[model samples]
Target chain A: MANADRIAGSDVFRPNLTGRHATGRFWQTAFLGATTVGILGLILLMLNIVNNAFGLVAYADGEDYLKYSPIPVEQLATSDLVVLLTNELSTGAINKLNAEQPLDTRSRSDLLALVFERILDREVVASSTLAEAVFNRQAFEADALAKNPDARFVFKSWVTTDFLTVPMSSQALFAGVRTAILGSLMLIGLTIAIALPIGTGAAIYLQEYADKSLINRIIETNIYNLAGVPSIVYGMLGLAVFVRVLEPLTSGAMFGATDTNGRTILSAALTMALLVLPVIIVNAQEALKAVPDSLRQAAYGVGATRWQTIWHHVLPQAIPGVLTGSILAVSRAIGETAPLIVIGASTFITADPSGPFSGFTALPIQIYNWTVQPQAEFRNLAGAAILVLLVLLLTLNASAIILRNRLSARRAN
Target chain B: MTQALSSLPVTDPQDRHVDWAARLRRKPRPVETVVQGLLFLCGAISILTTLGILLVLGNESLAFFTDPEVNVFEFFTGTHWQPQTGDFGVWPLVNATLMTSAIAMVVAMPLGIFAAIYLSEYAAPRAKAILKPTLEILAGIPTVVFGFFALTFITPLLRSIFGEDTVQIYNNASAGLVMGLMIVPLIASMSEDALSAVPRTLREGAYGLGATKLETTVQVVLPAALSGLVAAFIIGVSRAVGETMIVAIAAGATSQLTFNPFEAAETITGHIARISGGDLSYGSLDYTSLFALALTLFVITLGLNLVSRWLVNRFREQYD
Candidate 1:
């Protein structure tokens, strides 16, 4: 111990003077800071969404003003307030008695059940007029009378159930996005039908058949460029080509000859297909490229034709990737609003699209319309629509993830 | 020439009889040539599509320019974009698009590059596996949802902090910020691949010379991967430029293009959306202007893509 200390203390002994330690600490801190900020931002975004959604629910329930009750106007006007109170009590009791009357056995029970549900759902004890002023008829009546012991009954799941069953209308309570949902599904189906073949075929040609010539290079470049082209550009192209030039084909017999507008589900679908074609091609090409050259050579050596090799070996290996890409493309297509709007997708279609050639609206367009409206109820509906859209996108993405995991497992084996 | 001929020995035969038969086989067969020709033709389709778009756009734009309805100087320099009126200037729309895209790039580039650096250089295999997929989820979220998010959540938050008057209902900040968030995953994924492609030996050499992890990354790995990083940036910017729904829903439709982030402004895409909504006659200047704008957008994006491709090919290291 003494000899080591003497050596350390000696003049020839020089301490490690490299800046590596300081620089390492600096960078580690920087990296940690960045990661923290990125992850924190994502968490904040999710929390913000949840918070806003919860706020909407709270506003609908009117729980904040539940404790305050307004004095009746008759009480304020009359010196004999007791008489006014009695009159108010009599009116309420009589209305309750009338509501409970069972002219039809089935009707009486259903009314009783509905009244019970409303009483359970009420948050505030305000005068009927005040409640009417604050909450919508359904929310106010459901909540107000439910809390009043003197009142008839409670409200049930009418709002929740009606949310799904109804179709869009000017009235908030009657409005639903069923038509929009149906239109979205049809558009997605048609988009996939149009894009998958063209995209996969182009990818196959690029990866397998075409030699690495200048022309192939240009095609590859063009596809990448097309992928980045503003989706609105495709919308313009569709309007010009599909709507103006091929209006007859787009507008079918159902729309009538006078209805020459080509802003149908088919036109929107074709435009979206073009918008997402580049993404599909890029993904399909990557998948095709991942298939080992040795596999193709082996298949050919075994007397398999090029078509047979692609059909049997290449496609099976590439299926998961192709499906993943297709899902992503469809998800983007479903979320697209600008192109569809440019291609004249309707904002207020009350009826669901029965065929490809019918005029239609999609969820995004529906949400946009709802958001623009002045009413608070429509905003809530828009939130609900957004929730539905998120759920669909999440499902698609989750399936893609599952597919990718399966592919990874297979590759590992 | 002899060596090259010798490499293909099956073309020659030992005996004269076999040689004659081999010569017959050596001639290019019609079937093989025909198939190759067919493959080339299929490959030409993409080029044809590109040229077709250019030709269509050119013809339409030429018609638009000749029309008296289109004021050429006003279209280029005017700030107002009231198409409902006859006034047509593109400066405001162009300015908004460029400004928003610029803001998006500013936000996305540094964050994306840092994330890429950490993933490629610092992260363990498990961490990389988990973080990569999680980050990609950001990309998968539909842009419409993001738009709603920007409007409903982000806009209100900005209003609360900056005061109600400080932020417009449709300002560039929220759209550009959310767009930046959306593109980060894409840039990170590609940039990480580029950084990972840099040889480990370079890093080891730097470390052996007593350089720190930061020094090695900034000085050695970054310079080496400069081309790929640039490509990633260009692609990310292109994505930001092409984004439509985000700007449409969150950014306002007023084409009074100003650099102020708080102002409601329109983009070329927003103009397309707005004009297409109205009933315009076919072959009108208003209708053809859409094609002209699309053509310009196409040319810019195509130029960016070509540059990226060139950079990748010329500077990217190929490991055999």
Candidate 2:
């Protein structure tokens, strides 16, 4: 104790306190700056998405509505709009529209859409982003209209209800991510169906059944390593195996519906299942490990078999965690673009992915497709798709967290 | 009724199995056996996935290297990477990858490490909760979105700041910058774990010796957690190297060897994504080259992963 004060007084390890505090303050500022950068990055990302999702565009091919009907275009009833559309469209075109969806039963908006698409044939030839439209409207309208005097300049919200309902089109004005959204849902649904039970089973084995054997250890390590593998390599594997080797099954040739090749939703879903398997297994193992030993002992003491104990007790206790992991896995699968691109998702598919065997594109793929295009309007469209994808991701993660919290709360009780 | 009577009353501890010989000789439960077999099959899927990746890459890479136009030595050492003119050198792709990854590390390391230190050592619990989730949101963003962000926002920002003459529309610097943002969450989360693992005793020891809080963190705790921090940094590097969509979208599609971050170039992943998206005939050299690139990526990430795992285990054992 006497030596401690002497040591503190010694000049050897002592530094000037004021300089030390100054250095600490400087480092603290630098660290706070670092944290600020991350938050700023996130803010900019959201702003970019919103700043492009709605915009003003200079579009060509508008005709006077008075020429086709007595009423104005916006005020026209469904029958009036249909009349205007039928009078303007050719017989073959009418038949095609009818075949696509019944024209007689179509709503006013549908008929108006038909009139605009088929009769007026509006296309976004040029555009300004939401920021440009909002902050500098006069300049945007002046420049846009001057560039294309024949074109109509109007405000366009890229995430309108029609944008959610319409199918893909070559023209950016008419393009929507409906098919892509449907495909993503189908892929995530099928992927969860395949991955959940298997991932949970694997976790059960690793946590409860497998002993400290060499093979089990190897399997455990492999799962961890696989979790870290780049997702693109999984796409390559899918292309080589699911698309080529298992084409007969993936393309539905074995099921006698061989309209397409192996680049179907089934193949992509299968690839994603493999991609997320390790993540699910790891999370599920943590969940299973959290199950109390007392529950297992009680089950065994009651003359229950090991399978019965796992199935009835351990599994029921771990269900919330398993579901949480599966949801996270699904979120990862939905945002994945490279693998879908490699496994041959059609960027131009118009038809909704009707089943696992159907050709598909996803929301992320749609974003990528549009972002790569040279047109500025396509970039706006990509922003809208990104917003949708982000919303989906947030929803999935939110649900997972809520599920975990509720289950853990009940456990605490 | 007899079954009910016999199934009753096994609760007495004194009624424990007396006949050990008979119990040891009892028949195995068939239902339990089948259930375990099913579970084992489930566990085997991960093994099958690894095997599948290896087999697919190996089989196609075999076809690629054996082709007459391709030279093994040239493939590794050559500067050019055009497949049309029979040039299969991977260095251009490698260089672009390195340039972007180097830039990414430059941006990510200091920011990520500093943020980790702050979150672990300086942040209060409330600040930690809000900041950590916000960082995760940064992490949870899809890379394709970052790609779009890079192209639409970061690229234009750079072009305006530096002037269009100096910066290309699809420069490596923009992609690398956004890619660094994408990787910050990984480094921060992992390194926070490492820093958190440094025992409290060490910090107290530093404080006892007239060390300030910052001094304790930097001199004592940092050294104690160096192994895990290095592992986290290595993984960050690996992620930056393997990142695809950002480079594919923001970095240029053409391959050339250049260390200049302002210049446009294609990475290995960017090249593979570009070519494979196009219409390539099956079994062509171009298609085979994709597998080769994938194999290279796989091997690199796998090696980094193994080393990081080893380091992490060592660090954990030190504290556990």
| Candidate 1 segments exceeding 4 Å error | A1-23, A52-161, A253-260, A400-413, B1-45, B318-320
lDDT of 2 by residue, B1-320 (tens): 24633765645588675764465337477888898999999999999999999999999999999999899999999999999899999999989988898888888888888899989999899999999889888887889999999999999999999999999988999999999999988999998998998888888889987788899999998888888889988899889888889999999998999888899999999998999888878899999999998999999999999999998886663654
> Model 1, residue A4: displacement in angstroms?
17
What tens digits encode model 1's per-residue C-alpha lDDT throughout A1-413? 99877865776643432345666777766765655556665666565443333222222232221222244221232332323223434566545534544213323323322222232232323322222333565675556456553443222212243455446766553467778888988999999998887788788888888778887878887887777777777787778777767788887644564554688898888778777888888899899988888988998776565767888899888878888789879878888887888888888777768888889988888887776664545555676677677777787678778978888688669
TM-score of each: 0.78, 0.95
User: Which residue pairs show collisions in model 1?
Assistant: A115-A153, A115-A154, A116-A154, A117-A154, A117-A155, A118-A154, A118-A155, A119-A146, A119-A154, A122-A143
Kindly list the interface RMSD, in angstroms, of each predicted candidate in the order they appear: 4.1, 1.4
The numbered model that scores best in lDDT is 2
Q: What TM-score does chain A of model 2 get?
A: 0.92
Per-chain TM-score (chain B), model 2: 0.93
Model 2 in CAPRI terms: which quality? medium
